[model samples]
Target: MKKPIKNLGKKLKPCPFCGRKMVFHKEIRINKYGKQVTYQYYLHEDYDIYHDESCILDEIDMPFTIGAGDANPDTGYIGEYAEDWNRREG
Candidate 1:
């Protein structure tokens, strides 16, 4: 199982449509060049509160700086992406 990454002191705003809290999800992958790429974004799972089982929203992919091997992966992009998404009016 993949563990969700921490928000690094950044907090995602509530969902605009359902007012449910958003969760941060991160994925780390190794490219062909042997660099670690970190992808961080936010997701709002409406199913938890509404029980509709069909609504889901997510922020666009945010890529982090490439890192050597898997050590000290760069996830600083997550904070910037979260800040921008949280300010959305809709």
Candidate 2:
């Protein structure tokens, strides 16, 4: 299904690579059936630089919340995970 764009805001913690601060990059809004799901993603890089820089070091799928009433009774974000996968590998 088609989706809309939304702003999520700033990051909650600092970067693990350079210790720089991460900021909210994009809010991916997807509509399934009659339900609308919103996801907030962050940009671990500068605000000016375009394109995703996180792909350089590693890919991350951080934790987030679904907007109120965005999910229907049967479907929506069923789970969440931290972006700290880098720490798991030896």
Candidate 3:
């Protein structure tokens, strides 16, 4: 038998500190009733809280980071971060 579809509505919130808008970036798929379904999701607001930053694309260092959902391998480190490592001023 087939199952009823579920509505997946807005799942993002704004940052409390910086008031920046957030969006759904990640989700988990699971098996339910012999069918594939979406499970727990990490909201963007929660990400901002944990990251301790307001802007999602702000400066950050992940090479020496020690967290599960903290490192962003796509964009690498921030420009200012690289300058700081080189001990050079902008």
Candidates in order, TM-scores: namely 0.49, 0.34, 0.25
Model 2, position 72: C-alpha lDDT score: 25
> Of models 2 and 3, which has the larger TM-score?
2
lDDT (C-alpha) at residue 46 in model 2 = 49
The better-scoring model by lDDT among 1 and 2 is: 1
lDDT of 1: 0.46
lDDT of each: 0.46, 0.35, 0.31
Error of 3 at 20 (Å): 1.9
Question: Which candidate tops lDDT?
Answer: 1
Q: Write the per-residue lDDT of candidate 1 for residues 1-90, one digit (tens) a residue.
A: 145444532355565644756555557789899999775545553223334432433212222121222222264444555566557886
> By descending lDDT, how would the candidates be arranged?
1, 2, 3
Off by over 4 Å in 3: 1-17, 26-28, 39-42, 45-50, 53-90
Clashes of each: 0, 0, 0
